[model samples]
Target: MVVQTTNNYNASSGELWPLLFNSKMDDKKPCYLLCGLPKPLECRLPDKQGGVGSTRECVSDKGTIQQRITEWVPGHKLSFQLVKTDLYFGPCVESIIEQFVITDNNQGGCQITRTTTFKAKGPLSLVVAIPMFIGLKAIHRYVFSNWKRLSH
Candidate 1:
């Protein structure tokens, strides 16, 4: 199943995309703490060349999520494939695809959309989707809100 959420920000895609790519620019506190990496998170910034095929890993608590950049377009879009994850429901999750899209809006700012595609192992695994999406939505909103605020 695919879950998508979009939020409008009072910032241009040019302003937000660069921050998303720059590891040093992210200083917002993470909201989700149940299944992701532990406290002080460390991320490696992707190389230039559009960052395609670059990977980012996060380790927290006792879990870790490793994501690879599958597609990247500066000031436009970024997509990732969940290469590995040891989260709360890792065994039930078959695969995941995450994407972010930024586009200019008529409101003079930009619209940022986050899309996550999840493949479950079976019917029981599908049941876990609800809570997973709820947690994800919260984290996304928190991150986007911080991004918007920082863009000012």
Candidate 2:
């Protein structure tokens, strides 16, 4: 299953990419999605690195999720695959991959498209599909709203 969302911004991709991928967590508010299920209390890149093969750890009250960067194109795209997660949904979810693509719009700004792919475990896949999509859509919108606000 996949949940994807796109939003336009008045800022260039260069200006917005860092806001989403590289900004310091302390410089902004903590990310909290619906029901606090995947709330990330902290997110950091090891050794201040940013690129393919680099790892990122997102820690929350529930548990930590480690991701390995699979693709990195500065100012245009970024992608990562979940290496391990101890969150509540870990057992039901087999693998997760997230990607963000940015493209310049004719209006001198840019559009960001976020895609989240989920592979579920067994019969639970059918049961969790709808709810997972809804939750992820909400999460994408929440993040988009913050990006739109911060880009200015």
Best by TM-score: 2
Q: Would you estimate the TM-scores of all the predictions? A: 0.77, 0.85
Question: Which ten contiguous residues of candidate 1 have the minimum total lDDT?
Answer: 37-46
**TM-score of decoy 1:** 0.77
> CA lDDT, every prediction?
0.71, 0.78
Per-residue lDDT over 89-108 for candidate 2, one digit per residue giving the tens place of the 0 to 100 score: 88888888999999998888
Cα lDDT for residue 10, candidate 1: 86
**How many clashes (backbone N, Cα, C below 3 Å) per candidate?**
4, 0
| Candidate 1 runs further than 4 Å off | 23-50, 58-62
User: What RMSD, rounded to one decimal, does every model reach?
Assistant: 3.4, 3.0
lDDT of 1: 0.71
Q: How good is model 2 by TM-score?
A: 0.85
lDDT per residue, candidate 1, 9-108, as tens digits?
Answer: 8887888886565433255455645555233233344454347888755454457678899988889998888888767668878888989899998998
